[model samples]
Each structure stands twice: as C-alpha cells, then as structure tokens.
Target chain A: MEYETPLFFHVMRYAVRADRDVIDMVSGNPDWEPPEALREGLREYADLESSEFQYPPSDGLLELREEIAARRGVDRDQVVVTNGAGEANYLAMARALERDRGSEVLLTDPVYPYYPGKTTLLGGSQRFVAAGEDGQLDPERVREAASTDTSCLVVNTPNNPTGAVYPEETMRELVAVAEEYDAILLSDEVYDHYDLSGTFASALGVESENRIVTDSVSKTLAITGFRVGYAVFPHDLAEEAKSRHMLINVAGSRPAQYAVLDALRETDPAYHEANRELLAERVETFTGALEAAGAEYTRPDGAFYVMARFEGYPGTLENVEALIDDIGVAGMPGEAFGDSRSDWLRFALVTPRVEEAAERLAERFG
Target chain B: MEYETPLFFHVMRYAVRADRDVIDMVSGNPDWEPPEALREGLREYADLESSEFQYPPSDGLLELREEIAARRGVDRDQVVVTNGAGEANYLAMARALERDRGSEVLLTDPVYPYYPGKTTLLGGSQRFVAAGEDGQLDPERVREAASTDTSCLVVNTPNNPTGAVYPEETMRELVAVAEEYDAILLSDEVYDHYDLSGTFASALGVESENRIVTDSVSKTLAITGFRVGYAVFPHDLAEEAKSRHMLINVAGSRPAQYAVLDALRETDPAYHEANRELLAERVETFTGALEAAGAEYTRPDGAFYVMARFEGYPGTLENVEALIDDIGVAGMPGEAFGDSRSDWLRFALVTPRVEEAAERLAERFG
Candidate 1:
C-alpha cells in the first residue's frame, strides 16, 4: 500500500496555481456540457415534492436503478447506483474480499492509479499483469498473472492513459481467466462513449456471473461533478454490493440521479455519436501533435488519452514540474500510473485546446 | 465482522412491503420540508453554467467548503465535503488506521451499526464501551474502555437511535480521554440542529487535532438524497481525509453541492428554529403516548429518535416484526443498535404522524 498521490490530482493542484494562460491537458475531467435534458431534469426535480430532496434509499432511487438496469439489460435488482464509478469500483473489489473470492485484486500495468489506492484502502493486496507494447492487455498475460489468491481483476475498457479498448475476444478471455481463478471481473467502462474505433466491446456483452460492470454519467454526459454512477453485479452479489454501497457513501446523488434519469429517457444515439465525434477529433489532433513533437507514442485506439515517451528526460516529478512550468502545458508523468513506464507521459485531450496543447508540446520538446 | 444489515435498512425493507398506510418510524428519513431557500437554490443551480454540472474538484467546491468552514468557525482548508456523513466517518476511521494511531475503533454500545461495518471493511477491529442508562456516554466509562490499542472513538451527538446529545463537560472529558489514548475523536454532528434541550455542544467548539467533526445537510436540511456532507479535520489530517474521500467517492455531488451552497448562503437560525419547533412538538406527542402505553423511554435531548422498552415484551427481531405486522407501525429493535439493550425498541419520530405511531404502540401493548 503505497501512499503515492495520484498524478492527476497533482497536476490539477499545479493547474489551479498556474497562470490562466496555461493549458490543463492533465486530469480526465470532461470539458463538454451534459445533455440538455439532464439540465432540464433538474428543473423537473425542483418542482417535485420535497421527499425527492430527502435521503433516498441507501441502495438508490428505484426509478434510477430501473433506468440503469434497462440500459444494461439486467434486472433492476442487479443494479446498485453509486456515488460515482469510483465508489462502484470500490464496492466491486470489497465484495470480492468479503466473499473470500480472493485475497488480492489484480489489474494490468499502466493501470488507473485509484484502483490500487482503493485496494489498499480495503486492506487488500494488489498485483499487476504487464500489457503489451500497445498497452492493450493480453489475455495470456492476465492468465499468467492471476492466481488462486487473486480475488478480482479490474479491467478498464477504452482505457485511461493508453486509450486501448478491450475487444470482444479479449474480454471473453479475461472473463475466462477470472472464472478459472474464481476471480471477479470489475469492468470500468466509464469511457465507453469515448471509443473512437468500432471494435469496442463491453464486458457486459459477455454475460458472466463474475462480471461487475461499473460506469458513470461523468464521461458520457460530461457531468462528473454530479457524482452519479452505477454498477451491475450478478444477482447473488447484489445484496452485498448494495450494503457496501450504503456503507461506503450511503447513496448516490438523488437530484443528480433524477437529472440523469431524465437524460436517460431522452438520450439518443446521436447524443453519444456527437460526443464521440468531438473526442475522436481531439484524439487525432492530439496524436498529430505528439508526432510533430517527435515523441515516440502509440496512436490511441479509443478513449481520449495518448501516452508518449519524453525521449530526453525522465518522467520524474521534477521533470513533470519543469514541463508544466516551461511549456505552460500540464500532463501526468507515466511514473504516476505505476513502475511500468517511468519514461512516458499521459496527455488527456479533455480540454478544448487539444490542437494548441499538441502544438505547445511540439514547440517545447520537439 | 458480522454480516449484520443495519436495522434501518431491514425496517425500511419491511416497511416497503407492508401496507402503504403503515407508519414508517424505522429509518431516519426526515419527513419535513426543507427551507424554501434550499428549494429555490435548486432552481438557481439548475440555471448555472454547464461547468457546474461537470466534475467539481475532488476536494469540493470552494464556495461550499468556505460556507462549511465559516459555519464551523474554521479555515476553509479544514473542510472536505463528502458524499454524506457516512463517507466522512469512513475517512476519519481509515485515517486513524492508516497512520497507526490505533488498531481498534471504539464506540459506546448500542452504537450505530455502520461504524462497525466500515471498520470491518477497512480490515480493522471494533471494540465497544457500555453507555450510561440514558444511552448517553459517561466519560469515566469511555476512559475505562479505551486502551492504547484504540485508534478512534466515534461519537454521534444528539446521537442516532438514542438521541442523547453530549453536553459540553462530557464532550471535554471524552476529548481528554481520546487525547490520552492518542485516538481521534470522530464527532458526528449531523443531528446538531435537532437539539431540543439547548445543551448541544460541538466537538469543534473545543478545537484539537484529535477532533474531526463530521456533518451533513441530510438531517439538518432534510435533503438526505442530495448526499452533501463534510468533515472538519486538523490541518495535518486534512490531506489524508481528502485522499480517502477521493478514493472512496472521488467527489461529492456537483449540482447538489451547488444547491446546498445556495441554501447555506441563505440559511437563517430562524430556519433551524422552525425545524426544532416542529420536532419538539412531535417528541412531546410521541413521548406522551409512550407514557400512556406504560412504556419506559428516554426523552431525547436532541435529534428525533426515542428509545422505549415496552412492558413485559423483549424487543427482539420477532417482537419488532409483530409490532410492525399487528400495529402497522415499523420501528427498529434495540438489539439492532448493539448487544447492550435487547429489551428496548427504537422509534424514529421523523414522520408527520408521530402521534398516530405513538398511539398505535400504546393500543397494541398497553
């Protein structure tokens, strides 16, 4: 259990202090607005009875859970609305430990930093498999890394930092490995709508008893601040998930969930299509900028991040600080993710200034 | 750790299945209207710039933190807004364990069940001290129970289930005991505004590094679903609290924060005074009915719960079920609180029909 502060927060801290001119290509906070219906939903919630404002059920609002269950093609009882995808992930891992499924939670290298932090918080051990050069998890690698002691495997599709989406084949193999070890598969698909390629496949599509798919309206609706998320677990695990959800944070935001519910009713494929168009364009611009900067990097298959090795410098904390100071552009160093690639940097194209961020990198380090 | 579901949820589940007319004195879901300003706040928040809907900072919105800090007479940096007091409590206990301050979290018997559940989730042990006959903590008893192995003491003032608000002298003595044991004192003041005795004293009223006061707008504003709460920590402990807060739930609800921020800005003592007046009326009516029923009970000093022992009936789970089934009134069993008071039943007078619930109990058992 390392006490390393995740790099995104560090960059945000710097960004908060940095001059207004500085470009914050750091944290994965979406800059886009949530769906208009979600905004309108707040107005509708405002007009409802005050009971709507009071403490919702510890599990969640039934209507919101119903909406999520319908969307995920699961029964309403299988869904537990959460504080965010963050809380959902925590519950999934905690359930694995509580049920004696395993003692350790496993993930791949270049993982989401908070996964490890959460595992430590629950007093569970963590192990990692190494992803291939493309930063996409190899099924064989995951199989090799897993053991009978592994309690859960956390998989992030349309992955953060590397922008690698797990395909259907990869997802099945991952599920198989998890089942073999009696491990739970925690699929964090918060970035599902950010996929630029057509090959993205959700673990939910595979339908395993061990799969717990966690997601939020953060990236899809661009309302991370609303702090609304949900997870779908096997029916047997629902009670534990609900209890853990309540103990962890009580319940998700009620008004926000209502807003999301309203948005859900009105959400069109065009809405997701439109958001992907924006993220997809930004990925191209960001990758182009990386190429111009003479940085060695893999083009992202999905999601909105690009990982580039800063050839001349170590991606140490000091180097990251220098990059933030010298170039007026902020990004997280690869060291923040794990010991997997201390030489690279993670650039998030969540900002509107994707092209300028790209140009700035080229001008500063090319 | 036992896999005991808290009595609130169990009772709530029963209430949900029982007749619609069944008086739900089970959970502390406040059944009053929030201040008009709080509702107006939602509309104002509804119209805010879209950035308000986007992810707020992991710590919290500065405006909300500033409001909380001002109310608590602390610097803004001392506050970390949370999902609710639930998450705040979790973070405080987790910080105690992580820092090696103590190995076990101590509380008075007839404790809030979630505290022990959270300790178990964090892989920490829980210990208990027997509370006074009135369900109020006695300093000598706490001192006797505490040991060097104690890491934290969770005190819910104007306490839950029992509704015994800790007075200033007792609070000071409790703080002294905690300081002696090098244990953090987590004061849950969510029910601070419900004081009927006018003897409410805050742990924050006596400043010390060991005192981390947690609260939420849930009980105070009757907006439990909004999921807005905060904890005031010593500046040294603030960092750990913030890290745990982020890892647990990332951030509090965004639009809910905005709505609460607006409410805080306009909240007058008159508002709380009005709420207390209503609760005071309910308490008198409910307690009178209890007396008529030949039930022995403690009149709450603060908060809206009453603990009563029905004549010649042991308040076990089966008895509680019979009470709900026969009387159409749902209340929690005292055994659900802790092992200390198996003969008593806990009743929440949060609903408007407090007199009806009280009357039904009298008719059934008197």
Candidate 2:
C-alpha cells in the first residue's frame, strides 16, 4: 500500500553528488539562463510598496491574469494562475472529479508518470491509451476508448519521453472526442514554445468549451523554480478553479509572477528561436552517436530527448543502473514512464556533455 | 454547496481598487518591508548555475529543509516543504483522508474559514468544537469531542480571527486527546511569531506520534505571495506527505527558497523583535478606539486582529458591506469564520493607518 519510488528522484540522487564528470541526464531540469529581463524585473519588484506581498488576489493578480488572457485569447477571469503546470493539472483533474464529470481519468501510455500520481491523490482512476511508435497519439484509438464514465483526458504535446510533437489534426480530433463525450480535455502545453517541429498546435488555438489548457513560464523561460503557471478554463469552471486554487496553494509565487510578466513583455522572439535551434543541434549529435552504436532509436520531432534500445539487451532498470555505474552515464528507463515499453531507454540531451555521454554509450553498446 | 466566498480575498477585493486613502483592515498582510537580507540574497541567487532555475527538488532544497529542521528541532526528513502553508495543510489533510484514518475533521467553531473548505474538498466531513468566551480552547470540550472516527483536529495557535494563543497546558491536553483517539493533530503555527501575550507552545514541543506542524515564512516575513512553507510529519507519514506535495504543487517557489535561505542565515533576532513591537503598537491603538466606541469585544493575545460588535448590529455581510461603502473601510464578518458568531465583526490591525481606521469606526459607532 506504500507507494515509495520517489519517481525521478531515485534516478537522479546518485548522480547529484557524484564526481563532476559524471553525465546526469535523468531529470528535465533545463541548463540555460532565464531571460535577463526577469532579473531586471526582480530588482524593480524588490522596492514595491510593502503590502505588495500580501496574499495576492487568490485567482491571481489581475495584471498577470490579463497578460495570460491576452496571450491565450481568453478573458482575464478565465485564467487561474497556479504554482506551476503541476498545480494547474491538479486543479483541472480535481475539478472534473468534484463536479461528477467522471471518476475515470484517461491518459496516454508511456505517460508522464506524474499524471497518474495526481489522479490517485485526488481519488480518481486512470486509464491510459497507448501511443504509436515515437509517442504519437492515435486519435481513432482514443475516440474508441471514450465513454460516459470518463471524466477527463490529459494530453501533453511536444510530449515527454517519446518527444513527439502532436499535429494540429490529431489535436483537433482529441478535442472533438472530449466534446463529444462531455469529458474535460486537460492539456499541458508548457513546452509549446519548444516545438522543434513546426507542426505543433496548441489546444488553446482550436478552442472547445470542454478544453482546459495548462501552461507555465517554466519550460520556455527556464524558470521552473519560480513556480508561476496558469490554467485557462471554460467560463463555467472558472469559479471552481479559483476556489480550488485557493484551497490548494492560495496563490502562485508573487515575485515570480512579476518577473515573468516583465519577461513575457520584453523577451524577443529570437530568444525562443535560439533555444529551439540549440535543442535541434543537440538532438542530431546525440542520436547520431546512437545510430553509430548499432542501437535503434526513434528520433524525436520536438523535445530534447530520444528513445533508444541497446543491442542485445532491453532497457530495464538494471541496464539503466549499469549505464550509470559502469559508464558514468545516467538515463531514464522506459518502464519508469509507463508499463508499455521496457525495451526503450530515454536520454535527455540537456547537458553540454551530451557528446561525451553518447560516446560512452557507443563504446559499450557498439 | 458552492463555497463561493474566497475568504481573505473577499475582504481585500473591495479595497483593492478603492481610493488610496481607503483603510483595508480586511487582510493580515503586514505593512512592513521584509528583512534587507532577503534582497541581498536575491542578488546572489540571480547568478546561481543555470540549472538552479530548473525544477527544484520536489520535497524542497536540502539546504532550506535542513535550516527549517534545525530551527524546529526536527530531522530534515520529517519536513515536506510546500507552496505556502495552504499546500502543507492540504497535503496533511489529504494524507489523513487517503489512509482512511477517519471520516471527519474537527475544528474550533471560530475556525480559520479555509479549514472547513479544505476538508470538504478532500471528501471528509467537518465537526466543530466551540471555543470558550475569549476564543480559547477548554481542554475538556475538545476531549469530549474526540472520537475514533475523527481523522484530524486543526489548532491554529495565535488563532486566526480570534487570535487566541493556546496555553501549554491546553495544548498538552489537546495532544493527549488526539493520542487516545489516535487522530492526527495539525498545528498551524504560522502566526506564532506574533504572540503578544507570551504564551505560545508549538505542538512540536509536546511529543505525539500523530501530529503535524505546518509553518511558513509568509506571515513571519510578510511575503505570503512567495508561496514557500513546510510541514513536519510523523516519520511514518513523511513519505505520503512528500508524494502528496509533489502531486499537488511539485515544489514551492524555488528562487524564493534560495532567497529565504539566505535571509534565514543573516536575519538578526532584533528584526523579529521589531516586527512584534510594531504589531503591539497597532493592536493598542486600534483596540483603544474600540473601547472608547463602547463596542463589545475580546482582546487578542497574539496575531493582529480584534473581534468587536457594534451596538444594535449583528456582524452580518450586509453590515460589512455598509462599512466598506460608507466609510471606505473594509473588514471581514465573523459569520464567514464560523456559524457560531453572527454578531461579531473581525477587523485586522494590519493597515498602516490603524489609527485612522479606528478613528473612523469610533466616529460612526460612538
């Protein structure tokens, strides 16, 4: 009855204190500076009126909500700023349950594991639809799985682990299924800006009354620690979202909100272009090493990761462990994400030493 | 069934867009600057390794937890850092419910309004124990209320709304009751630093296996918007607390954690002393005006609020509305806190113009 894997922490703890040369790629922590405008924003916020730090308006500061609304093409009241996309997802799922929307939550196999955990915490059941090779959602299969008891469907595009950037047609079909079944479609589009593939479409773009889009300044701005995110809700669910937000975390981080507000206003489109380009180069270099090692990998269309299978061995937890201990290279096991794929190992090319890590893997696997 | 009142926000919202001269005694937001050490800390954190901006460790930064643990006299593992005490309390209550510890959550009648709302959200029923005349707990009343089905009891010392700082003997007896019934005792000591009557005992100071202490820098440091707090759970419950925290909010504000760490390291005891002194002055000035106006009220021992009843008026929402519209002053009605008090109005002494607010109240009531 005790669920105690510590999830991603179990994979990263060993490498945290290891020698500096050890290549740690088990987590999604970005390796880049946030926009300079954020730091400049912090300096200005530090001198605001003393009461500026009061319990911020529970839904969020109006100014920040206004900005999020403008960016998403929603009204200010439709936005509920949250601690992170983490909390935004929690609020959405909890709302679905609270309103008797459904006790059954739907997810994709090879899922971001945290989705299942959040569903469990809120006392709801999860049923995942397996993705196609390289993590593409099969819209027809998803539509088949829809039922009256399904309360929610979660889609993470520019998806994690498999790294597929969902196409607009697929996204439209997903939204249609949610609308047809009267179930909530909760999308975590925090990585929308990092659409390495130009075909990525946001649920926010093709609006439906049942769609709830959760996003954060974290991935794009590289400020995950600041904990400022938002959920755009259907107008009907907006009040519930606000109340639930208050009961859960009260409000998002205030200083982070101000900093992000400034960053959003001042950040040049070129900043996002540069980051996308950097990820593309890393993906090419690391996947090339896998190809040379005689390993089979699915090249990702967007996110900075590739899923590969080492020749002569499946990617089990033990193999992941040995890769760390024997080669000083760490990676996430596919099984850690979902039960569907134990043969695939997930590698994040987030570190500057991706080439070295790939060379080490090629030395043994080749 | 729709719990629409956003509590603290309902009080503060009216004044938010009002004239600058409007005195808002509706919120506990302090009218003072945080320690200068926090600003200097920000400057240092601004330059940390780029990965520092990535997701923080889910439970919290080890260094910050270690500091909180040392100060609270608990081991680092017992602390689960959360997004403000809001999330800490949510995790604790949800854990209690998830384990089937009990079906009901107990609270003082004049409770912090947020408690009942949280218990409801987690699918648990709420039971109330009415406070004594001055909003103090009579150990016997609480002991008599205890039952095997009571999953948890929340005691906020320097109680919000009433400001009753529970006596050590009362706290000890309350813990004994929870021990006998084997129910969790959640002590929210966020306001302990504001103890004016000098009688504050942490539930941590009295050992009990079924207890959790939720604290935060928000109230003490005057930065509720920072959204960083922690809960110390029984060793057996620590894992559940961590999992629930991750599922709810991932981690608290990361940059705030670093800044608070530096502030914790450099803050002089003199700083807290000065803050306590200022609250003492505000309480005196405001309450003196209450007495002169012939209003019936109970003085608070800690925290920065006083409960008073204007002659011929039963502290209803309508009365509060009149106060805001007629006098440009805002306050919370006691009915919002609990159903037991329909005749008492709660006024926070947080405004810098406590004297002016008091003068306005006296002119109208006297």
Candidate 3:
C-alpha cells in the first residue's frame, strides 16, 4: 500500500530539513507557476456560486471534455476525466483485466515505476521488455514481449527517468503490434507538453481501436496537487473506464476541475514557451555538472530528469542514503524502477536555483 | 456502470426544465451557501502562488488532518482526506477486502445504495439486515447478521433515504457485534451535522478499535460538488488507509482543503444554527403537507429527507414517474433502496422553495 515516491521524498525531507543549503533533485515536479491567465481563471471560478461546486456529471463536465477533444483531436465521447493520469492508467488496466481474466500487462524495462506497481496491485502479471542502451524502446522488443495472454501494454513517451520520446514511426509500429496481439495500449502522455525536441507524438493520432491515452494538467499547468487528469479510450471501452474511475475515486475535485478548465481556455502560448525554455536551460546546466563530475548519463531531450551512472556506485538502498547524507542531494535509484542495471540513478533538474545546485554537485563530485 | 442517483436527478432536471413549476424533491443536495468566513478563507488561499498546486503530500495536507483529528477527538495520525464520503467508504471496503480475500460486507437494508454498488464493484459479497418499520436499525438484527465471514459492516447514522439516526445504545450494540466478529465498522457520518433531534452521535466518540468514520463538508457547507471528505481510522490501520487513499486518488483539492480548514476554524456558530433551523422548518412544513394529503410516513429525526407511503399506491417505477410527469413532483421510489413490503417514496426537503413544493404535492395527492 505504500507509495515509493512519497516515502522516498519523506525520507529526503527528514534528512535535509535541518540543513539550509540542501538541494532537492529528487522529485519530478515542475519548478514553475501556472500561467497568469490560468490563475485568474481559478480566481474567477472560485468567486462564482454555480454547479461547479456540486457533483459534476459522472463522466465529466462537457466544456472540459470538449477542450480535451479539441486539443487531442479526438471525439468528445472518447475521453473520460480522471483523478490524475495515475488513476487513468490504473482504470485502464483494471478494465482490461476485468474484461479478460488471467491477462498480463507488458511494460518496457526501466519503465515509469507506477506501471508495474499498478499492475501488481491490480492482480495482473507483468512482462518487461528491455529498452536499448540508449534508453529507447524498440518496436521489435515489444512485439517479442507480446503474447496472447497480454491484455494491456503501458507506454510512457518522453518517458520518466529516461526521457525517451517515441518517434512517430516507432509508435505506429508499436500500435501495429498491439493490433496484432489484440491488446489495449495504455499511453501515459502526462509529459506531452514537455517535448524538448519539438516533435511530440500521441498514440491517439493513430487510427486504432486498441489505445487508451492518459494525460494530466499537472506537468503542463504546473498543478499536480490539483489532481485533474483524464483518459481517452475507444468508444467501446470508454463506459467501462468511466465506471471504474468513479468506483475507485468518486470524482476529481470540484474547484480544481473548474480551475483546470479555466487554465486550458485562458492560458497563452507564450506561457508554455517560457516554461520550456526554463526547463531546457536547467537540464543543460545539470547535465553539464554531471559531465564535469565524470559521470556517464543520458542527456534527456525532454522532461526535467536524466539518469546517470557514477563509477563504483551501484544503485542500492545504502548508496542512495549515502548520496543524501554525504552529497546533500537526493535522487532515485534505478533499481526501484525495474529489473535493470543497478549502476544508474535518476536526478530531477527541477530546482529553480539550477546553477547553484550544479555548482554544489560539482564541488562534491568534480 | 451508470450511477442511479445522477441519472435520476438528470431525469428530474429535464422535467424541471420542461416546466418551471415542477417541484424537485428528489436530490439530496443541501440548500445553503458556505459560511461567509469559509468563502473568504478560500479567496485568501486562492491568492497564494501556484506552488500550492504542486503534488500534495500523498497522505494529505497536515493542517487539514490536524483539524479533522481535533474535531473528531482522535489522534492526528488517524485521519485521511479523501475525494468524498463516497470514496472514503469505497477505499475502506477495498482495504478490508484486500486484508481478507472474498470478504463479506454487511449493510443495513434500506441503506445508502452507494454502499452496495461500491461493494459489488470491488468484488465483495454483500449481506443485508432489515431496519425496523420505524426506519430505525435494530441492534439485535445487526448482531444476527454478523458472521465469521463478515469482514466489514457499513452503518450510516443520520442515514440517507431514511432519516433514522442510530441511538447510543444501538451504536454500542453494533460496536459489540463488530468486536465479537472481529470485523471492521465502516461508518458514514456525512450527515452528522444535520441532526434535527439534537442527538448528535459519532462512532469515534464510542472508543471502538474496529471503526472508521467517513464524513464530509459537502452536506454541512452545501457544497456537494466540492468533493472533499475524510476518513478517521484507528491508529493501527492509519498508515495503510492513508497510503491506499492516496494511491487511489492522490489527494483532495488544494483550495477546497484550505477552504474547509478555514470554515472549521472561523465559521460562526450562528451560521450553522440558522441552517439547522431552516431545515427543521422545511421538514415540518413538508410533513404537514404530506399528512394533509393523507399519506402514511415516518417523521424525520435528522437529515433533510422524509419517506412517505401512500394508501392504495405501491411505490413502483410507474408511480414515481407519474408523480413527476403528472403531479409535477419528483421523488425516489423505495424499491431502489431495498426489498421491503412498504410502499414508500423518499423526498428531499433541501430546496429553498420547500413550502411551494409541499403545496404542489398536496394539490395533486390530496
């Protein structure tokens, strides 16, 4: 029942609370504020006494669904609002498993930890396909992992920990594989807006029935705590997904939904541009420090994270604690993610004072 | 998959929209604005920077937890914030089932329909014990329902559909049943503040180890759509419950949480007193109209609902729809609640125009 992210974060908080100069490079939080327009929308929505404060339609508010449809280029009926992408992913898996018992969920090795965690929690078996050394998921590996028992496959693009964005061709091939196996594809596109390569891809763009897209305003709007997210499914499965979502968590927050709807309608393009620039700059600064420290790491094309391998530092629980205690920084061990190599560690470059954090790391490891 | 309440209310809305004169006695919504102090507190909290929108501590905001603990007279570690009382009840049952596979969930007959729906969805078995003809649950009947296979028992005092509040002796007997069977007591006390009989009771006040209380500000503050609720559990199960709650929905809304905290701290006593008085008056007016119409019904002791039985008219789907279509009044048929021989219908006196509604009903039924 314990969540690894919060548990690790709590440990780090306790480790550094007394130290004023401690740097937090552990959480995958975006160190930016939502656009001014979004904030104003929240203010306006909060002022009005309307049905927004009452129980919303079980599916979702229409305007929010329309906005998602407009942005994702899908029919409004294809989408369902969820608590967050996490819950959406969980619902998709649960629905798929319920529809076909004794089914397995396929995951890419070094996947976003939640995928496997949710799979286990839902009483489904998981099969992992190793990503190449470049941290990219190859279509052939996925095809090899697919089986008649595989009912669902979770794919996170511009992925967490690795930051590998699947190319259009790769996604098309993967969709073909899912079609061949008759499996549901659960695409976690929560980090869609953070594609630094300027080449974002979505499985929903493909013409296929075996796809469910999960995304949230957390990363895009810098409002993770608001917990407003959604899933897009084929018309045939949308009802089941919606039902499971409601049964699991009655509905998302009333005010937060209004705020998210406002954020989407009013936020300017320049706000996203500014956020992208800030994140790109921080990623460069931190990766440069990692290089100066003689660390081997994958420079992410997107997201505010990079996985680095330090000499003689096998990613273990003991080493993780040492890094926090001795270096005054916190990062996730790759071992916690999957059955992959144990020499890598995940660092989040989401601190506002990126330059200072880089300097501190350089002083300790350079 | 579809929720009966929302669907029923939607049909009621369609009828209301078709004719503005139609009286809505179907929705369990409260008819009062949030306390002014709470609204102001929300405005103040909303003005804070977007950092407050970041991912919440998986458990919940510590301030809200402390407030709930102080109010419930429980230890701070015993409280967990959930999406709503619905989600709290859902998660509590899920946790119990996880602890004991294929657990049986015992519910009072004519109980809140959500309990049975959620339990069935969670893959748990449900057993029902009939409450007395007075619309009150009998302790001996509940004791008889408890068995070795019973993993959890759900009790809603100040109950829904039927406004029967469990007295102290009845609650004590139920607690003994739970303790004897080693089963968890899942108490839904969302309507705790709406007690018109001046007999406010809580399972937490009874000092039971096998009890969890689910309550929300929705009813008290008249913000049913805000979707903010909490569950207070014994210390032994607090961590598991907190983790499962967060895993399911992450956390409740930031602004809503801050608003409830402010409401709990600053809302004047007179505001609540006035609300109670208004509801009490409506109950009296509506009951008088029903009596004049020659309907047989039990007087509500608490909550904003009254269940009435009509002579020569068994409560059926046809009758409920006829009342809406011809009589221009909407109510829930008793069949949806449980299998009972009594021909009854439920009316929610939560609207401001209850007097006019009563007059409209009297015109048709009398």
Worst 10 residues of 1 chain A by lDDT: A1-10
Local lDDT at A290 for model 2: 92
Q: Point out the higher-scoring one by TM-score: 2 or 3.
A: 2
Off by over 4 Å in 1: none
Poorest lDDT segment (10 consecutive residues) of candidate 3 chain B: B1-10
RMSD of 3: 2.1
TM-score of each: 0.95, 0.97, 0.96
* TM-score of chain A as modeled in candidate 2: 0.96
How does model 2 score by TM-score?
Answer: 0.97
Q: Local distance difference test, per candidate?
A: 0.84, 0.84, 0.78
How large is the interface RMSD of candidate 1? 1.9
- Please give, as one word, the docking class of candidate 2: medium
lDDT of 1 by residue, A8-127 (tens): 777778867876577887777778777889889998998888877877777788888888888888898988888889888988888887778668888778888999888887778889
lDDT of 1 by residue, B292-327 (tens): 988899798888788999867877888888888788
Answer with 1 or 3, whichever has the higher DockQ: 1
Candidate number of the best TM-score: 2
